[model samples]
Target chain A: MKARVTVSLKPGVLDPQGRAILHALEGLGFSGVTDVRVGKLIELELAEGTPLETVEEMGRRLLANTVIENFRVEPA
Target chain B: MKSGVVVFPGSNCDRDLMVALELVTGTRPVALWHAEAEVPAGLDLIALPGGFSHGDYLRSGAIAARAPVMRAVADHAGRGGLVLGICNGFQVLTEAGLLPGALMRNAGLDFICRDVALEVVTTDSAFTRGYRPGETITVPVAHHDGNFQADAETLDRLEQQGQVAFRYAGEVNGSARRIAGILNDRRNVLGLMPHPERCVEEAHGNLDGRRLFAGLVSVLA
Candidate 1:
């Protein structure tokens, strides 16, 4: 089994990289782009019996920093 | 005072920190590898030097924070041992949950490397006791993700508790309230983006950074 973790900066946290990308997109003639927030996708391969709790623990411990980012796990 | 310096792979400043510690404490600190699960006994201070730990994989300091030695550093901190984290070390501290807030990419989207002016916001903590409150000093900072961010509530709590130890005198990075350094709630741990160990000698252009280590040694001794 494989799990994909999507880690995103929390709301109200400034995403400078996202902002820069948004600016670049606007400069390239793309409009109506209100905002852009960048995040990370971490793919994990685990044994079939791996529990969701164990995956969540991995997120808490190393996959995501709860201080500035939140993460959600999905079966891939 | 017995001190230890945690050396993770790619830690370029470990020797600098060791030299500074030896200069002030008159004893070379033990170089503890990142794989070590324990810090040596009878340590008064543990210094986390700056470098691109784990090549800034995932995020700056994210991987290194989960290294085995950090657990020992956290435990030592819990025992009231003083911990000083500089530059990348600061990021590791935040990632390790030993400090609040996280260092984000600089708002300008550029890597800043230079001497930055900082004001001592709180002289009460062991890390800032050598300087007077409101005094401005220059320290060298070299980081791409030095912009510090946290929730409004945590920022307010840091302010209310006087855990904010240093604030930038000028806009160097888009840090909240221009925070350059901060102390843990217990006041024993300090994390800052500037490299104090880089300026601990007269040959280093300025000696303003020396007082920080001097103060630590004085207080701990």
Candidate 2:
């Protein structure tokens, strides 16, 4: 089994990298680009029948910092 | 004071911290590897030197925080042993849950490396007792993710408790309340993003950073 963790800065936490990307898009004449938020996708290859709770535990423990970021686990 | 500097694979400032400790305390600090499950007994202080631990992967200090040795460090802190984490070490402490808040990317989206002015917020901890409150000192801060962020309530609690040790005199990083250093609730653990060890010697251009080590020795030794 494989799992994917999507980690993103929580709303209201400033994202400077994302803001820089947004400015770059505007500079390139890309209109209607209201916002850009950068995040990370971590793919894990786990043994079959690995519990979803275990993956969530991984997120809570290491995959994301709950203080400033949130993570969602996706099964593939 | 007897001290130890935890050395992770990517920790580049371990030697500097050891040197600073030796110079101030007049005793060599033990170099504890991150894989070790237990810190040596009878250590008065455990210093986490600044560096790109675990290559800053996943998140800053995220991997190193879960390292085997951190359990021992936490136990040490739990026993009221002093802990000082500088720069990357600060990030590690927060990730380890020994301290509060998180270090985020600098608002400018650039790696800042230079001497910045910092105001000592409180002289209440073993770490900052050498300086008077409101004293401005120059220290070098070299980091990309030095911006500090926390929820409103935590910030207020820190202020009310005098947990904030140092604050940037000017806008150096986009840290909440311009916090440069903060002490744990017990006041024995301090995590700060500036390189105090780097400025401990006169050859380093100024001795402003030396007082932190000197103060620790006075209190803990």
Cα shift from native, residue B213, model 1 (Å): 0.8
Tens-digit lDDT string for candidate 2 (A43-65):
99999999989999999988999
lDDT tens readout by residue for model 1, B1-221? 88999999888899999998898778889999999997789999998999999999988999999899998999999999999999889999999999999999999999999999999999998789999889999999999999999888989999999999999999988999899889999999999999988898878989888899888878878
Enumerate residue pairs that collide in model 2.
Answer: none
Clashes of each: 0, 0
TM-score of each: 0.97, 0.99
The window of 10 residues in a row where model 2 chain B has the poorest summed lDDT is B197-206
Q: What is the docking quality class of candidate 2?
A: high
Docking class of 1: high
Listed per candidate, the RMSD to the true structure in angstroms reads 1.0, 0.7
TM-score of chain A of 2: 0.97
